[model samples]
Target: MKKIILGSLFLCASTAYADRVDNVQTEGVLSSQITMTVADITCHINQGLGISQQIHIPTISTNDLRTGNTKSVEVPLMVDCQASNDQPGSIAIHLVPAGVSTVSGDHTITTSLDSVGLELAWKDTSLPALIIGNTEFTPAQATNNVWDLSLIARPVLLAGKNVTEGNYNASLAIKVTYY
Candidate 1:
């Protein structure tokens, strides 16, 4: 009789337990677009200036460098600003020289010719000549916002230095400011 009562009590306890359940739901959305824009000034290669060019230098003996020498080549600076901004906006131009010189108001021109010190200058037809690391704001010609400025690359030798015979090359960075 005690066993029967114990079995009945165990069955009742098992039935007294309860069950639990849980659930979750979620939703997400992402919709966006991106756009990029530039300033109202553009550098273009309509002719010869916008591209790399080689200027021939006058041959000189080692002693000639003591007095300094100059070599120059003519090129055109073409730019398209017709639709660059609202109306015919103005622009500013400057040049940064590529060299290893640390002298104030002086820049270097990296070239294959070793032991030779050289300087570069930009001669605009409408403005005074600007050396490397200089800025200027003068337009040579503009028609409907198409700028056609004339430029000359003038390289001069540093005094009291000797230059070996070889070809030298350097690229100038042109910075344009628009208003």
Candidate 2:
């Protein structure tokens, strides 16, 4: 009887150990893919200037619109670029409206105020007016991989539309591509 009891206890212990082993998970796989962008040049907005820039346009009067004179503010944008080698990379920048476009017939971008819009151009007038979302302005390198791109913004009234007086706001995005 003693021998039989001892043998049964051993059998029960073996069964419990087998069940524990079966419940254990033994295998798994983890995977990840890495991708890199290869470019000869990289450009960034100057740290001090930051990515967002605000141009303050002084108040405009209806009489001012009747005449050709309007207040224009200078927007100075500084960009820093680095080339992988001695050869400088080509950089092109374009402006895009951040929100819905209200482009008027005169090629001016409409602001929040009705009939009121803005016109953008390079400070160096020889470069020509910057057509919103259409023209890419190529900036000359003022120094070693540094660009002092200056632009001008002015408020104008559309023809036949009455101006609404209130605060007006508009946003523009500067997109840069390097090759």
TM-score: which candidate is best? 2
lDDT of 1 by residue, 4-97 (tens): 9999999987666423222323456878898965544544554425545544656655555544545556655666655444433455666655
Can you tell me which runs of candidate 1 are displaced by over 4 Å? 1-70, 83-88, 99-118, 126-134, 138-144
Worst 10 residues of 2 by lDDT: 82-91
Give the alpha carbon lDDT tens digit for every residue of 1-179 in model 2: 87899999999999878868868788988799999656455455664565587778998777786574798888777667644343234556677666644656433677887777777777756254555444443435546667666677788887788866778887777775555
List TM-score per model, in order: 0.49, 0.63
Roughly what TM-score does model 1 have, to 2 decimal places? 0.49
lDDT of 2 at 41: 56
Return the lDDT, model 1, position 137: 44
Clashing pairs in 1: none
**Model 1, poorest ten-residue lDDT window?**
17-26
Model 2, residue 149: distance off in Å is 2.4
- Cα-based lDDT at residue 114, candidate 1: 52
